[model samples]
Target: MGSDEDAVLAGPFWYGRWDETAREHHGGHARQLNRAARAAHYAEGAFDPDATRAAIAGLEIPVLILVGELDFSPSPVLATQLGELFAPGWVRLVVQPGAGHHPWLDDAARFGDVVTRWLAGS
Candidate 1:
């Protein structure tokens, strides 16, 4: 992302709550940094709608959808859509507060607890 977009979009890419450690860590290991800009272009082409429909229809088992509260890209809104798609069954949707795209980095303890509880069927 450009400098102007970094202040906003980049935050979602990393963490909602920024710190020196977070900045240093992500900066040192910015995976796919070279092709970040081209990702949009690569994703713009047509996708297989039939495959997507079949995949959604095949999700018969319970699902636990987690989203960061501060993530704008795949925010809780997207999680809600997934929940709807997995309808007529148990679909747990979690919006971890103050979390960005990487919820574990934003709130590791909470993320672990949530996932543990979900896995334990609580």
Candidate 2:
């Protein structure tokens, strides 16, 4: 297996509560760095922002965007922008306080409650 040290280091940025156990768990099934890099490259190349926006705009179903307050990559502001693409009341943006990229990891109970409530309401 490839070294998981890099994955462990990146865990903090991807997950709010990336502890040693989480690191080990993720690392256990981690792919080689080059393979991961290639996948990421392909994913990025395949993404089209305009197409995504058009698809989201055409959605008839309610959209719930959950963002972590502490996450910098797709910050709350970005989430807001995404929500704005949809008609008013069609998209709901919820910012989980003190959470990073992974809100469930930061606070499982609260995350579960929020998601459950939202789903129930929907």
Candidate 3:
């Protein structure tokens, strides 16, 4: 995330819910730092096309690509790419309006509805 967002989530004065220690230990300090270090180490710059394309093309199971309307992390356009990764007609794209990165956290009702409908269709 960018600076403002990161500050609100992690800064001492901005985080009204808890102190710095608590924030660091949201998943426990050791685990959190370990995860952060690992992520930094494996950070991406260029794509490994052959590996990525082959992995996607190899999947034969049904796939549901769900993205939030406000989430540009992976973007809704990714749904089309993901759909092509699965068997034809076996991929569904669901977008929840007004939702951000975590759609279920943003709107449980809509998220549940989508999941229920998908299960019913299956």
CA lDDT for candidate 1: 0.76
What's the residue-level lDDT of 25 in candidate 3? 37
Put down candidate 2 lDDT per residue, 45-107, tens digits, no spaces.
Answer: 578889977888888787889999988779999989989988667877899988887788688
Score each candidate by Cα lDDT. 0.76, 0.78, 0.64
By lDDT rank, best first, the candidates go: 2, 1, 3
lDDT of 1 by residue, 21-115 (tens): 56765665556366666576457554666777678767777788889998876878987886776646778899999988778888889999999
Off by over 4 Å in 1: 1-13, 31-46
lDDT of 1 at 121: 93
Q: Whole-model lDDT, candidate 2?
A: 0.78
Model 2 spans with C-alpha error above 4 angstroms: 1-6, 17-45
Let me know the TM-score candidate 1 reaches against the reference structure: 0.72
Instruction: Give the residue spans of candidate 3 off by over 4 A.
Output: 1-47
Worst 10 residues of 3 by lDDT: 11-20
Which residue pairs clash in candidate 2?
none
* Residues 1-122 of candidate 3: C-alpha lDDT, one tens digit per residue: 45545644543322223444435534353343576766776678546778877887777766778787766656667756666766677778987887655576567788999998888885
